[model samples]
Target: MKVLVTGSQGFIGKNLLAELKNKEFPEILEVNRKTEQSTLDKYCKEAEFVFHLAGVNRPEDQSEFMDGNYGFTSILLETLKKQKNTCPILISSSIQAELDNPYGVSKKAGEDLLFEYSEETGAKVLVYRLPNVFGKWCRPNYNSAVATFCHNVAHDLSINVNDPSVEMNLVYIDDLIGEFINALNGKENTRGDFCEVPVVHVTTLGEIVELIYSFKKSREERTIPNMSKAFTKKLYSTYLSYLPSKQFSYDLKMNVDHRGSFTEFIKTPDRGQVSVNISKPGITKGNHWHHTKNEKFLVVSGEGVIRFRRIGTEEIIEYFVSGNKLEVVDIPTGYTHNIENLGETDLVTIMWVNEYFNPEKPDTYYLEV
Candidate 1:
């Protein structure tokens, strides 16, 4: 099928084209600002489907709204009529069309024109009265509050929230693309006056700002945002996209001593924590017993012997492990434990604990094992 996408360089237009390519659509006719009028005419003459996404939402001149929104629709429809071609054309309209402002008026005018054309020539038109569509690739500080918040927070810049109580209805770009593909396959979600993207999320302005801000602080705090909800998952993904490439990796706090270094990897409230422990040759560490907190020590590199002894008892248990044959030794509750480097090289062990360590109320106490 020949798919013609106006404003192909724009956020939604770019995402739609990528999805079409992923689906292996044969031909795509991309029309952008730099593309000549003659080229658009040629595309209209051959397009089997059209995505009319170009519009003037943030024009310098207010009068340019009508010209770019309504006037451009007129030109595109006229080209389609001149060639006597009618394909399934989708129009990206705004929910603001329900308002009485100039931009809204222009968008409503375009919608009316499409409805009239569909009525007259039996041409299929799907007009989506979209809400604040946001995702990766959207311009920051331009239109979307989500985009602006993500960009600013990722860059360590402050974001302004004018109305904390104001709630926004957002649709992720991936969801929009999925819906567009559904329409292309003749399975659109339509109602009386327009179509809608099925998945939508709503959050107060303050909540959004706070959530995105926490993402920037996650590395320092060693915490992760709650991702059980779909909205947060999408928002987190979008936030990561805005992070500078240089800031992609973060440093972990390591506890170093003469024996070796113990670096915390990741910690979770529900899933406990993981760390890497390096032991110098002939060095021993963790001569301690936990009342309730237990751990798993996996020898990942070099050779090691993990020793465990029941508290208040003389019995000792030992396990020999090495990098060549990986093994995990569990430190049971109420058992004193220690790990010793058995080889000439440093021993590296991956450690997992049942909970995040707390200095004030550590369940560990020094003991011989």
Candidate 2:
């Protein structure tokens, strides 16, 4: 079904769009404050549902919040009311709407306007009050506490917490997106004028901070250096993996060709041959070296650390792997290397080699680790 989604550029909106697309929603008409009227009207007319999610989420000025959130929503509702053919309207409200903050007040006003418009126009309306949603591709900044916390922890930075014991409920972004898709599909019957809707309550700030701190502490205890890109991706991937839904995991595995079976993707025609297996936790692999081959790998499943020593070099490189990321280190013809599964689940990988596999005279030479 065709759906028009406002605030298409925002975090939640972007995630919702992806979710809908993944579910094979026929078409998505994206709309935002910057979206032109002609474009908005075109999509609204063709859509079977309109998800209103645009407007300023956290404005520095209270008035900006009012104008951007409440005012913009009013205008959109008015426009929809005038449509020759109306569709169900879903407003992406915030849990903050129940609070006293300006951002919350504006969202509350926006919801009120949606109800009023639905009453006047006989349009179906659904409101979703989202809590602290976290997951992949989330921006780390002042706008999102979870993102900021994850960012700091991924970088080995200390997390400052006002209270470390409070607990809060966290709704994964994928879960929130699933709810929106469910709403659009009419999986849940709607009452007249408005629906009671679903609200996800997240943990208290202290609890959230502690969770992140625990991850950081674990990484440190393992003597894993935060290797920028690879490590950050690993942490984020792990965070997403913990979400209580298989929708994302399934899609990711498909995209990465992770079928719980070994597969090899040749990087160059003759330079390398690479194969990977998704093994259970605590399984140690690759305690061997090549006399003439070099290799590289990226962890695509659970977390782990690699310990390697180069010939004629007293220093050893200890690297941690997590998430979905690429890590490269040369074997220098004859150096001992091995990786330990530090995570609880199977360790997965996309490994690359400098030469094709040969059973006999195979580049690999066994070494004691």
Q: Return the top candidate by TM-score.
A: 1
Q: List residue ranges in candidate 2 displaced over 4 A.
A: 189-202, 217-369
Model 2, range 158-235, lDDT digits (tens) per residue?
667777666655666666676777777887434453443354444478755655665545333322223253423344
lDDT of 2 at 201: 47
Superposition TM-score, candidate 2 onto the true structure: 0.58
Q: Where does the lowest 10-residue lDDT sum fall in candidate 2? A: 246-255
Give the poorly placed runs of model 1, Cα more than 4 Å off: 289-291, 294-300, 303-336, 342-346
As a TM-score, model 1 comes out at 0.88
TM-score of each: 0.88, 0.58
Candidate number of the best lDDT: 1
Model 1 lDDT per residue over 199-237, tens place: 989888898888888788887877777678899889999
